[model samples]
Target: MREATHDPATPLATGLSPAELRLLLSFAYTGAVAGPWPAVLEAAETSLRYQAWGLLTLCLDVFTRGLTPETGLDVLAFAVAYGLAQVGRVAEDYILATFPSVVATPAFLDLPAHLLIRLLRSDGLNVLHELEALEAASRWLMANGNGQEDLAKEVLSSVRFALMSGRELKKVPSVAAGVADPKVLRELMVESLAPMAQLPCRVRSLQEVLVVCGGDKLTANLAARKPSRHLWFAHRYLSAVGLVKRVEWRALGHFPDGPRFRHAVAVVGNILYVLGGKCYYGVRDTLASVYRYQPMDDSWERLASMTCGRSYFAAVALGDFIYALGGSSGEIYCTDTVECYDLTPAFPCPRRCQPLPMALCGHAACALDGTLYVSGGCDEACQCQASLLRYSPGEPAKLLAPMNGQRAGHIMEEAGGQLYVAGGLCQRDGQTGYRDQLAFEVYSPKLDIWVLLSPLPHAHVAGGAAVLGGELLVLGGYSHETYKDTHLIHAYQPGTRRWITRGTLPHAYTDFQACVLTVPPALQWVPPVVSGNPPPPGYMP
Candidate 1:
């Protein structure tokens, strides 16, 4: 095999068109392909044909990032054909995330039987009910007609028909007619609902783990706040005798170096990047250090520090770069400076982006649809802000509708295309001091409006917030009124529009980072069920 040439017109031994040859050669040389998705797909196929693993990887990344409801099936099929398991997994996740919309797309009708089977078999399918999954499969079968009887039988085994209730199961016959024999479907339903023999438990996919990282911890004796270096993640959930619910947590070793708080963390692919923050209580203790952790290897590597040390700032990963926005820095304290670090470049350093219209600290931020949204932080004057600002590189930050009220030290996370803000400090009743903000609010980007949601049952100030299992989780943070840290985790499900206690952390922790990482299967653990009962009401953790 020979390396591709720089010449645009050069013909390769491969039967790709001139345009595709150029696209492949460009990716081989400059590591970038410029064209529509169809052209890129052609080049990707060419890379696979020629055993060009590197080019194929780049193509896979493009496919992964470009995935939408419309393009997910195509990407999944391509990834499966190329034996790119990781890309296929990501495509599967995207498809599951937008399953309802994906099923409505024209591509859904054209999905091959095997690919449809692969999707239906996933435990992570984000369907509201098993019946919806049945409906999707039935639609596919009806479109392809009776020739897919084998596919229908496969769908029967692939779908979790047992998860449906008696009333839900009644609808199975109508859906099963084209996909599988009606009588056989009934038998599966019966066996699944109640089996004489013990069967393997069905749990949601553990492809990603929810990790709680460095935070401030309060000792048992009501002692001083100490920054912790501990790292732990939820290993498994237990269903014990007497309906006891417990979540087992496992340690994944400490983050390299000492503990810090007010730091910003973000996940790019499977890697976790821990950014600048304060190492200790002193204002001078702010750090410019940066490091990244690879969950698969349980290892960490220090990266080039930011241009300036920052604390109480927001860091979000957007596209190929990480943006460190308004936070308290050395000398100036609260500064409006913003920096962007390119993850693709070796030895990357921070590049300045358009600064916020005003300085912010104790603020929270998250990325959605490649745009960065920041809200609820204090200015240098120490006045809380309710302004919602939208930012992008090379563009002036635009302020949208403000929050219901001023807040700081809050947690802002994006779930289902909307931004959710909860647990913050805010002034009320003309009081000089700040109190916990319990009123939760959500922002709609499309309408440019903010509306209130049910307030957190408990105040969550300065806690770690992340979306896991399709719910917004508020991890350990101290309430402003009590001045005590909590280890309990609270989850807000969008469907129910209510908050429920998920579980507790290994210990009382606050001011820490929370983000999900894709850990290798070797590091995952599922403990045996224990004997106990549910935590009593008003029980913390």
Candidate 2:
């Protein structure tokens, strides 16, 4: 028999052998929680230092019926620390809501300040009175936590708001976002009403609304700093829409001039990324530009003067380049030309790429590595296109296998290297025209064939699709009569062949485009190991 250590300070190896440790590692890695794990919980906690997530990780596999006392805190810490952000942040909520011993301070919040703040946020502050003591625990944490930490301030803010209602009903956006006060809100409303007698033609602008809305940093808001044309419309529109209980646009100053952005715009790396099309009139005509919005200063700058100014263009970003595919580029075809913009240098003017294989304008394009796959656009004949084409780097575009049917204005996504096509218009026999498609298709490069997958729950098209943490998210787009108002994000898991609905976006949009910039393979998942366990959970294909 092996002799035990005489010194209590010295590390003591439990009776479990190295072979048993190896077996526990195997169960944790594969999530094969069907059978019993031989080792006790203490052994697993010790391994967390080496595995870096040994405790919580094992718990994630066995969380429900699986959460042993040993693995609970570790799992919560692990999920919070890594920002284990998933679709709907389901994993995060599971950890916070289910953990039995997670209320401990400083150490329990193993996350960075920002993450800790997020974990504690709650909206609607309505909870059952039974859990009041547990809910009030947030106040204790805020008081005990360090003042220097932003998380402490954030938590204190939430506690203040939550205490008023005494509830834990909502998984709010984040505490760092600042909690609101009812008393402050009422005072702000009176102050906003103070300004209502001022501009008439200012009918609708963001400025009027901001001045009256009474946000936390109202003085520093865009309307107060450098007012835009929409500032006027913002106030008037809100009041007219009954959003503002009693407010008028006349309180704000003169509305500003031409073409100001009216949406949540962004500029990643360089390509001027804009969302939610807005119309700004010139002196003579009401012209709407495909506004290339700049995030640096929230400025709206036009790109390429747009051969045709139209919303709902199919946008696909690859490498550092953005290819604006088919939409109404005016004159029948969105010009069949793929407008490629180099986003790195943040070009003042966009440089157009050569036209696509042909003028199948308004098509969907999906990028895999450097090659772009284009499909489903209207052709010169004015018929919806279902022909598929592949565009490789430095190579001319060529047609590949066509979809099983004709679908223009469809949505495209990729999983497991196979392209997934969502709902759109599909015409059979060139007769009975259908506004929306109930079917979907998958294209396999190896097989060089198209296979039909499960049909969509509802009919829609031109929606935005993104693969986040391995789930292919297909969001809102144009439906039959009007642009779909719902963000309607759905996640497609190739493994289970399932489509699960997720949380909606901050604002619903069909005119906008969404491109998920994935961190390269090296950084996204784990680095290559010679031979060991499979990849981490939820890695993109």
Instruction: Pick the TM-score winner.
Output: 1
User: For candidate 2, lDDT tens digit of each residue in 1-541?
Assistant: 1333244344437654554455455666775433444343343444443563655455444543333223444444554554554412444443343222233333444434454454444321212221232343344444445444443334444332212221222322232222334343334223322333111111111110111101011123325322123211011111112111222222212112342322222334532454222333222221234455322243555544444444334556677666665455433444555556566664434555766767665467677656789887777766777789887646788888899887876778776568988867766565655567767789988788999877776555655555544456666555664534444556555534666554343233443344432122222222132235465443321
Clashes of each: 1, 22
Instruction: Name the candidate that leads on lDDT.
Output: 1
lDDT of each: 0.79, 0.46
What's the lDDT for residue 265 in model 1?
Answer: 93
lDDT of 2: 0.46
Question: Which 10 consecutive positions of candidate 1 have the poorest summed lDDT?
Answer: 525-534
